[model samples]
Target: MQTAAALRHAQRILVITGAGLSADSGLPTYRGVGGLYNGTTVDGLPIEMALSGPMLRRDPALCWKYIAELGKACLGAQPNAAHYAIAQLQRIKPDCWVLTQNVDGYHRAAGSPPERLIEIHGQLSPLFCQSCGAVDPQLSEHLQRPLPPLCKKCQGILRPPVVLFQEMLPERAMETLHEEMAKGFDAVLTIGTTASFPYIHEPVLRARVAGGFTAEINPQRTDHSAAMDVFLGCRALEVMELLISHI
Candidate 1:
């Protein structure tokens, strides 16, 4: 209720989301690509190593094996009510922005404006050639054919724009985030993430430091929960619609 009131009154809002939010859509919520794996892959490599940028360069087939699985999982699921609720909230609040770690692109699928949505981790579709920089639109088709999809233009290996392990976050997304953070927010509501990383928690701290409201929604208390003005211990799917309705 407090978070809803703060969001309703606040003109500038930042809604931070993570993997847990998309899990409501039946997507797995583990490390790397919603993480269909836990300890190691069939190749006997750690999931992180198998999904890393270096691995992609060294053995694209191995890397893409996992990538394809994640891609299939994402393509199989639809955005749930919470995603739609956030999209609706964005429509209601012109200044509302979504900063998400998810690469599933569910926010975009749920009708959140691309300009207002920041996918810090990048996305899974529109695979591009690392060699010729050619855009490949046949991700689903390629998935059905090969281990490492190749570019039609140059026969180069195609990969998603997503930020793999050991890869840097997208520069443009980071720039946009910093620009908005400089402008500051009146309310910051973090959903579904543990706020374990500095980037994840920085916005919340910024809002609080600027004398604004900050809250979090998660089924369990997280590293940043104690810092929030109000912590809603519930799934985003369970409360996001209620929160948006109040707005």
Candidate 2:
């Protein structure tokens, strides 16, 4: 049973999620049991190199392959019980906020109100023209070739609308998050992520600084996991579902 005493004692709640949350829905990653990479997974030459921004720019083909694989993985993915539970948790508290690192759009698809949720990394819903900066509407279509879409204006290649490895978190999203943390959360739950990146890590720390109940749920111990008051090593969605069922 979830001891939601922490939640019960607070009126403000913030939920943060990372890739681990999506992994539970069968999205592939190189970590944990039965993950995609056997030993060392790389994007083009290797998983690490492939994900590097320099590599992405140098070899668009490699980036395309990596992104397309992700697209394929997302094709059959649907919101799991955990995603729904997060939504339910939002409704349980009137002042609830969800900050997600995932670009999968799962949180939005799961019925999380746009006003209450922020995707710091951008959305997986659309591909954008890098040259002209135009974003295409989200639609599922088969890629006949292994290339990113192009800008209709300049014919320059398009890229996933998501923030890339070299990119910084959107300034607007970051500012809003800082302000939200300043407002004082009742409890803060970081699900399936290690706050490795500066932008993603600070808000969770902010919650802790404010004496907000801090927690995390992931399959492995992470840098941020040790700092949490309640750290549960399990699939993010599974833990979320359990928490939602009780509260």
Please name the candidate that would achieve the greatest TM-score relative to the true structure: 1
Q: In model 1, which regions exceed 4 Å deviation? A: 30-38
lDDT of 1 by residue, 83-154 (tens): 999999999999999999998999999999999999999999999999899998888898999679988888
TM-score, predicted candidate 1 vs. hidden true structure: 0.96
lDDT agreement with native, every candidate: 0.90, 0.73
TM-scores for the candidates? 0.96, 0.85
Off by over 4 Å in 2: 1-3, 30-44
Query: How close to the true structure is residue 91 of candidate 1, measured as C-alpha lDDT?
Result: 98
* lDDT digits (tens) for residues 1-247 of candidate 2: 4336777666888888888888889876423312236544453155555554576678776666666666667766877778888888888887889999887788888888888898998876677776788876543562455466566678877677676566667788888888887787778888888658776577668778877788888888998877788888888755676677667
Best by lDDT: 1
- For candidate 2, the C-alpha RMSD (Å) to the true structure equals 3.0
Error of 1 at 123 (Å): 0.1
Would you list the clashing residue pairs of candidate 2? 41-47, 42-46, 42-47, 43-46, 43-47
